[model samples]
Target chain A: MTGSASGLESPAEDLLKVQDLLVHFPVKVPLIQRLISREKVVVHAVDGVSFSLKRGEILGLVGESGCGKTTVGRTIVRLLEPTSGRIIFEGRDISHLSQSKLRPLRRRMQIIFQDPHASLNPAMTIGRAIGHPLQIHGIVRDAEEVRQSVLDIMREVGLTPEDQLFDKYPGDLSGGQKQRAVIARAMILEPRLLVVDEGVAMLDMSVRAKVLELILNLKRRHGLTYLFITHDLATAKFLCDRIAIMYLGRVVELGPAASIYAEPKHPYTQALLQVIPTPDPDKRRKKILPRGEVPDAIHPPAGCRFHPRCQSVLPTCGWEGRDFIDLLDEHLSTSPKGVEDDELLGSIGEWWAEGFEAGRKTDAKDPKKLVERVKEILAKAPPAMAQAVQSVEAKGEFVIVQFRTPDKLVHTAVADRTVECLLYQ
Target chain B: MKAKHSDPKRASSLPEIPLPFLGRLIHPLIRERRSLAGALSWMGLGILFFFIFIAVFAPLLVPFSQTQPFASPVLQAPSLQHLMGTDNVGRDVLSRVIWGARTSLEIMAIGVLIALAVGFPVGLLSGYVGGKIDRLLVLIMDSIYAFPGLLLAALIAAVIGRGVFNIGIAITVIYIPLYFRVTRSQTLSVREEPYVEAARALGAKSHTVMFSYIAHSAIIAIPVIFSLSSADAILTAAGLSYLGLGLEVDTPGDWGRDLSDAQSFIGVGIWWMSVFPGLMIVILTVGLSFLGEGLNDIINPILRKERS
Candidate 1:
């Protein structure tokens, strides 16, 4: 099923809607250190993401590891509490609901994890593990009825000879069998929405195809909707109706799967698509993989999170003090140390940046020479970075560098999708 | 299409023994026979069972009452009439030694059971509901763990006074930290496992997740700690009695009290008074130690696999 019929569906048909959802995890600090600093630091795992899914939709959440696609999926199912935002499922706000209130709603939403071996309790038999949810929710009280329901779900998921496998432990089953059992456990509750977080990533290639097919089959039989989270684009293309491309905890582009694959709008999405391997030997497609490791989430880039690694970066695309410090650090480490250069700019350690302004103490050294050295460094830097700098001035014993305020970024609607980029705007 | 039933890795390693229960019990011992720990564990099990047999049949096996005096000369040597000969009180030494097994076993069982009863739930709550409760429990347990086992037992024994149950309670105080530390650490690790999270995601309450998922997996190391601590408790119990803080004089036979009484006679060359009882304590403690070590060797690999 694809998004051919999506345009015709009314807003009333929306099954789930997320508005600016944010999940920030506070970094643990020692008590003495915390008291002295009085500064609270948090990892902006899922900064501000908004998306919606229609009924009977299979929306794929595609991103690199640590980009927070899994976090979004978890937050939707209320497995993780959102720091701020609204999660409207079936027309009710579930974002701030208490756990007890969410318990009844749990029957309508479920999550299947990546590693099946770890997701099933080693001590519990497959039958008991699968039927436990029914008992917990008090849906099926009779022992025989629970067993019958468990056996039926097992048979549906293609775990044949269900009677024999029912009494077996997780260690007794193979990887594929364990995954199928995990899926069976989730499906036995007859949930309306399933968030499959890399559900088949750990399985063999042969088993992966079978599990994907089973997922599609289950959706068809139950008319279930899915928020599929995975790093594998090919698998997403094969299964998803819509695709949302995430980079550094934000969705850069979101649209129909076929159109996004055929013509990616965002630079990050284009870079991701080029890295996917093709079978043909004669076609040597140029790979444009992004450079540098992901920046720490504690202090993400000021403007667009992906601007640091974006190949098509613009002057207005959110570059700040941290980026300048990083560039200076790179320059200092590689170039041979000059006595004059060392005298003018004491060390990289003395330099500090916040927002668009970066300052370094002169310490009685000539401020004019420091300003000149900074300008000289900027001359050789990337054109976009150099153009973004507004001025460099010397005042008292400190040299200050100021960058221009970037153009306000927003999710602009392009041809058939929404892209958060200056190029689209 | 029917999926092929691959044999479970654990079941295949076990030999095809007739009795399922006995085979399961002996499987780890047989598998680990090549290791020194395994060999020692087997010897320990044998010694432990021998002592257990004596403790169970103390009434039938003893030749005289544990405390009664007879019309025989004191400090008599080994003979057919007195068997291992009479003590300084004109009582049979063999009967007292045989009866001491029952006392030691009683102290061990009660002491360890009490420690487990108090320590397990406290640890489970501390580890599972971690934060302030965890920090508080860890502080308390660490303070208890800092004290020497005998010294702590002695202090408690002195305050609680002497008797079988009181001595057991005294010994229990020394080991509370051991069980607490083991269970708490195990719970802390198991709480992070994916299965525990999965159970929580399935609408299971906090208590349900703690007991069913976390507790089930965390309990693997408890048995290993149990046997080893039982061995340690035997020593502490005897030490308490030796210091004259344990059972009353002329009560059912106790090794520590007997050892204490024999100390004054040892210089006069009455070797029988101390040798038999001392030998019994050493054998039982060593047996328990071997059992504990062997269990560690067998169970540790399984725990490691579970973690991975």
Candidate 2:
């Protein structure tokens, strides 16, 4: 991949590379429950996310709140351990390193949190909190030296009158000043890369612009690489050299910010870009929001994670038994003759779905009528859902509805970007 | 350019005032919460310090010996010679009351400090590095907390035998669970704060994050707990001494011991004997309770704001 910005030579050497990173958090279950169903449930927070950061490059991780962008940012910095995958920093795999072993490496990378108000120790003075890292890493032993360094960073971040503000507590600072102090704290370590996890998301609009300006300025001045995690595509367009649009826990589209904005390849990216509110009052546009809430991460949809909500969904996008069940439920709820359909279909509780196959008990009902009813429901469903059905037949005492196995989805190169969509594949 | 808005004069005009150790400790609390509750807390603090000062300067404050018995003047009422009157044994009632503050202060200091020292770390560890260890600690602390405070202290005092230190231990046992529960709960919440995560991302050691970030935030509740438990400790110490599980009689002046001694004299209407000591106990306990209540009012809002 080539760098997006003009007038800057793109470096071949990667400062940070994350390969197939996966972070799954185990959900706590009662002992008896765990033992009874020996299924180890986990939240697939960041699954198989891969990216690389070039020196001085600003890579934006953009997605909705639960899209695992924050988890990916945190996992890259080793704040959250990756359940699998390699995180190579400067040609060394540092993902699995113990915290003690990661200490020295931490000085080369840092994280700026989302909330300025909550990201500072209230009891600690601004100066002490900012300088604490130097003490922790034993980078500056002398208090005076640490103070000078902290004050320098404090000034750079525009928390001015640094000497006086040094003794003031975080409680004394406004939200903007607090965010600046937090930035100064991270900048004091002189890290090569920064994972800014929605760093300016909590700031006011005017202050957000200033902070974004400061971020860009810092990048230029310090030659720093940034893994900028934000949900605002407009902010990403403003600051990012490249943007990776994540959906659920996977990167759906990743390419130059300008190109992606000009021509979004993935349907998810297109939908995301289409929703950015225009500043002009006269230019009213239709918002193409993805249907339904983000699916639960515990059991992410198979084939394509976004297919369930994709507006331009293809037949092979990924249709499974759950989708069929969802279609049946929707048809029953909205059908004009719902009472007749309910009697024909029986209670949905007796239906069972696993993988691509759904079956209903036909012992009480006529098996031929059950198959006919299932076919009628499919005929009224979304074309993609109906087109994916392989067969509907009465086998033994059950009417089994089987769906075709979708082709394996893979990230494919489209114009100026790589998108994980069947449309591109 | 943005820095120009801030007045350099105003910034420099406020001189840094180097406070004395105790003033420094209390400066933030008083500064943050300046209300009627704050004034009441100050009054409570004053009462506590008044007792402490009397305890520290007991020898100079009262002239008559606390234990020495005179032949004539037994059961004398308040007069110029011996204010607060003389006890049944003719020992100065005023002197015994003044000296009793020392014993109570000692128990308060030992009980609170030991409880804080032990409970703070245990609770911090249990909450910060949670899992089986947390469950285990919560179980243990809850078990200890389930027993009635005075009953547990009395039982411990009964088993350990009697002395100032033994009574202090009894008070400590009663309060450790209190501190543990408060610190543990606070730590549990503070552990989830974004600041702690920021500190960890900065590569702070587990101990540093625990003590510096988690402990510092968790410690706000401790003072409230400290004041309340100290009031409880004073009562526990007195209860132990009254039940014959504290210092031996006449070795040092003790309110509980003196009150016990004056119990029989009440039938003769020599009220001076029990009244003064009982009054001291009541006054100190009320002061601490007010201090604790006022502090809770002042700090709870701050804690809630921090959480949000």
For this target, which candidate reaches the highest DockQ against the unseen true structure?
2
> How much RMSD separates candidate 2 from the native structure?
4.5
| Per-residue lDDT of model 1, residues A262-372, tens digit only | 999999999999878888968968788887988888988988888888888998998788778888888787768666667777689999998998988777555777788
Q: Model 1 off-target regions past 4 Å?
A: A1-12, A333-347, A363-370, B1-26, B65-67
Candidate 2 per-residue lDDT over residues B199-307, each given as its tens digit: 9989899999998888877888887899898998998888878877788665558998888888998998889889999999999999998889888888788778768
lDDT per residue (tens digit) for residues A1-425 in model 2:
12422323436778889999999999999999998998899999998999899999999999999999999988888988899999988777889899898888888899999998889987778999999999999989998999999989999999999998998878779999999999999989899899999998888999999999999999999999999999999999999999999999999999999999999989999889988988997887878888888999999998999999998898898789888888787777777987877777877777888999988877655688878888988898879889999999999888889989988888898887889999878
Angstrom error at residue A344, model 2: 0.9
